[model samples]
Target chain A: MKYRHLVITDPAKLIFGTAPYPVKTRRGLHIGGGQVYSELNFTLPVMSINDQTLPEVYAHYRQITEGALERALQLNSKGVILEFETLLEMTKSPATGVEIVKIMNDICESFYQKHGLASEIRLTPNDLREFERPALQRTSRLLEPMFQLFEQGMLAGGDLLSIESTGGKEVSDEALMMCDIKAVLFSLAVLGVRDMQFLWEKIAALARQHGKIPAGDSACGFANTAMVLAEKKYIPTVFAALVRVISVVRSIVAMEQGAVGPDKDCAYEGPYLKAITGIPISMEGKTAACAHLSPVGNISSACADLWSNESVQNIKLLSGMAPVAYMEQLEYDVRLMNTALKKGAAYSRTLQQLLVESDVYTDAQALVLDPSNVIRISSALIQGDSYVANARNGALEFIEILEETLASGRMTLPEMELSYIPVLREELQSIPDSESDFIEMMLPLLDPSKFIPSEYGL
Target chain B: MNYILSKLLEAVEYGKVDQGSPYPPNLKGMDGAHELTQKALDAGIMPQEILETALIPAMGNVGRKFSENKIFVPQMLMSARAMGASMAHLKPFFASGKIKARGTFVIGTVKGDLHDIGKNLVAMMVEGAGWTIVDLGVDADAESFLEALSNNPGAVVGLSALLTTTMINMGEIVEKIKENAPGTVILVGGAPVSTDFCRKIGADFYSPDPRGAVEFLKQLAS
Candidate 1:
């Protein structure tokens, strides 16, 4: 069984811990194990200082820490996603960097006293990296000791520190990895905690940084480390941490290639296709692929390759940050289909024939008619049209049927499916422009009384 | 006699770039805007007539559809492609002064950000609405914007930023633009930016989608 972790932090003491259950609050809620466990009831007091300044923001940090700890304790959470605003609020006053560090340590000690629970504290390396913004890099360096003190407090108290590597363009993998490893080492040394989880790939280099695992032995080494920690009775508290670390590594690898499907292969499709094609291919799969390929800019090329390939099965296309890029490729495929059909190109008949032959309707019809796997069908229709036009035409007729059904609410999908199957089989058996005939035959049966609206009123 | 042009416009409005474009499948295998535009031109249709009668009306319909949420990004892109295909034939006429672009619109994503989806959409929509666009691309700064403004006096400037961190840069850029070119119209957008934020930054316009930006530009041009 998979277990989910939740962490909560204390502002005054700077200690963090995981809740055994979920938490709820008036401001926000954290759900754990299908129930609300705690509420983040603490509010940041309005600062008397400038709103934009980091110091002013940090002034409210104490309140935030207190609120976080209280909420976590209330929820009995095992882990928590740390909210940065609390720390930002604490730095507002004219407190020296040392003062801030002391306050953080105090917060951590408070957690030890109150709940005696170790916390999984999450932090984004991106956020830390952002503090090194070009304009602030020099000033931040000058103030490094203060930051280090604060870091020390966090390390000493945090049972788990989740770090994210992807921050900005300047945050390279090497840099993020170095930063994460250093932070983890600091946590281990200060807090006597060996459990560290990374949210992105930047932290994967830590084991290597410490010393390379023997060839083909990285996974074994990690597992051994967990076992060693567990034998020391850290397992009950740190297993979730180990899982998080593993998830980060897996997610990073997946991001590099796109999302891993249930098959562990990258999915190259999305959800919009369901609305367009009525097929439910996994959006999660395409998302995985996007996360994998987006950093490298291979999304367009991969899509082009998918479109041009004739023998490829499961022609799932990956996506990018910009939906426009995907749309651009879709547009290109559509244009190619149009050009082939109009010129009566040899491929056009192949496409049209495929559509007529196929059981599925047009990409549009498939999308509208079926929402579950529309994305797959829409992508398939595009690929099919690129390869063969008769198939494309058949797909178009399917779209027409979908539109007609949606517009008039006349025919049951099963009835439509029943009517469409034979025609499709006939067309497939013999390639022809069977769309017009199919549309004509279906028109009489679409007499409103023939179908009942589904629960969604579609 | 201009029924072909009307049909072409309708095709574009519905994102039918040509007979083969599978979007808006209701018109599948029928002549799309691409074919119809070329056909209209081949039959000696005037470039201005194609622009005014076919392209503009078609684009207007698409814009309306977009505002109504009847269509979305993919559909709008198809319409834009169809408009672009038709406009290609009219390019020479614009150069010869037989057709005129309403005005120049300079656009860019604000500094410290590499995101461009929002910027590109605005550029395409504004271009399709018959304005010339000078896209400065992503991670553009105040100096670049100011230079573009100087080069194209009276041109409207638009800024885009998708990140919360980068949105702050927009405030600085807007201030600089106002200092340098007080008369220049500044349009701001992106996920984090709200109308309230736009007002705070002193930008002239704020739009959530491409069509809103295009409409704002059209109103300014007219």
Candidate 2:
């Protein structure tokens, strides 16, 4: 609850490579104070690993990590963050994830201790609870292994504990397809908020016990899902944009429950999270083109403390391994931003403006992410009385900015999409301000079997 | 066209599920697909005729609007719901063999993946096109697909995965299925799936949208 109101009220004051509050890792890596670090996210190629392939899996990870670090040194990057987002099998076999954690941490320490360079690891285990139908069984056997892996990762000298926990995804999946804003809000603001509270409480406690940084969670399973659907033209981009804003309430719960800054890279809602909580955020933009195609390639980096490549595989390319190539790309991107930062405040502001302007008018998803609009939407978020109201107001604020943008002839959207704005506006405005009333109204419309109300403490 | 049948078509086209649902503002307070469909049945219209002339065409229009970007997932999903309401009244006819299905389509999100919105959408669209869908649900492994195929011989199997990590499982699943059942036809899809990947993975088809999958199945049935 550190943020009662928006910390950076004036959008002009908000800049990349720094946050009002920065998170310092155990190895003296300051995530948000200054210097935009490159957070390299890499994964295995299209291969299955079993008991017989365990040794090969280790070899692949070693190659990717060693190759990436070698590139970092060549680029002369000041600091880098290696995010080891474990695959599902890694979590199932906790020893495998822990061993990989140990291997990555050893490489990072060796690089730092020998080369006088700094690096850290953000160990994210896949949230396996999402693999189940009910998806929210707190006591399920599948749930504990994730936390066990996190604990093991911390003990293995991993600096950050994070997970892309998919709490409300089961319900959000259906709501997203129907564009049911109320149901979407319930899934994210109510069900997701409760899950974040329960999940992050444990994670933050574990971090405290281990004296490690509990980096934030993401709405990747929710908003990022919508964005991908929208990108494929299956859903309206405006719907995805609104979902992104509303997602901040649930994601910020990670912060409220004692998790500190430098939230996950894929949480495109990171801008709003950063604006409200003053937590440094890791954002992936142009460099993330290796993972997925997105229109926010430029705007995503406008307020980022860590510029990331979403996750490239260890496959080889003309230059070298894919992860190594991506590390080089991320280093250059961070170098430009860090260079702007070093020059002075004016240079940083100019660079931020260029990043904002490059992608703002091209897409609705990008427009809502403009740092100035993030401040405005986040301000409305804090002023609201309840989580549901906060999510509603956030969506309304996003619509207002979108409408203003469209009305001013700054951006032109397709007629089909343009017509849906008023429809969404009316639907958002129709929602009751009280959380209970909103829940009561939405419960009947949602398939009771699709979600367990008791899981949300209804 | 019969008035009730025509009204049922409009209801499905506009996504009016029932008289209680307040969507497509213009159609509020009107008898929706649920009511019109029942009235059409009571009027002695053949279930297959209603499905062929009204329900199927209505979903076809919805899918067309979706592909053309005139409508998106929400509008199309509403239409799917309206079609579902109408289909409920026709299920007895289908079970009694009074109406025929095109073919069986078995689908699931691959192992190590739980995302199913896209898979569910394909199921809905394909089912709306008059096919029997055996949904294997999410995290369905290779054995699940083989078991489903053995149960429904000559069925088309569809595999889906949202993450690049889990999508690789599709290749393994496809390989296992091919090794066990050489002539099995498989379709693969998801955000990361491309026609190129489809060919590389030995899948028979890959469609970026549900409408394209329906089209491919229609031709296969033909």
Chain A TM-scores in order: 0.27, 0.98
**Model 2 has how many clashing residue pairs?**
0
After TM-score superposition, what is the CA distance of residue A158 in candidate 1 from its true location, in Å?
A: 6.4
| Model 1, C-alpha of A16: deviation from truth (Å) | 22
lDDT of each: 0.43, 0.88
Off-target runs (Cα >4 Å) in candidate 1 are A1-52, A60-63, A70-106, A114-118, A127-202, A205-458, B19-29
The native-contact fractions of the candidates, in order shown, are 0.00, 0.73
Task: List model 1 lDDT by residue over B33-108, tens digit each.
Answer: 7789889989888888888788887788877765664544545677888887777777889889998888899999
Question: Candidate 2 at residue A122, lDDT?
Answer: 92
Candidate 2 is graded, for docking, as medium
Q: Highest DockQ among the candidates is held by which one?
A: 2
Candidate 2 versus truth, CA RMSD in Å, comes to 2.1
What DockQ does each prediction reach against the true complex?
0.10, 0.65
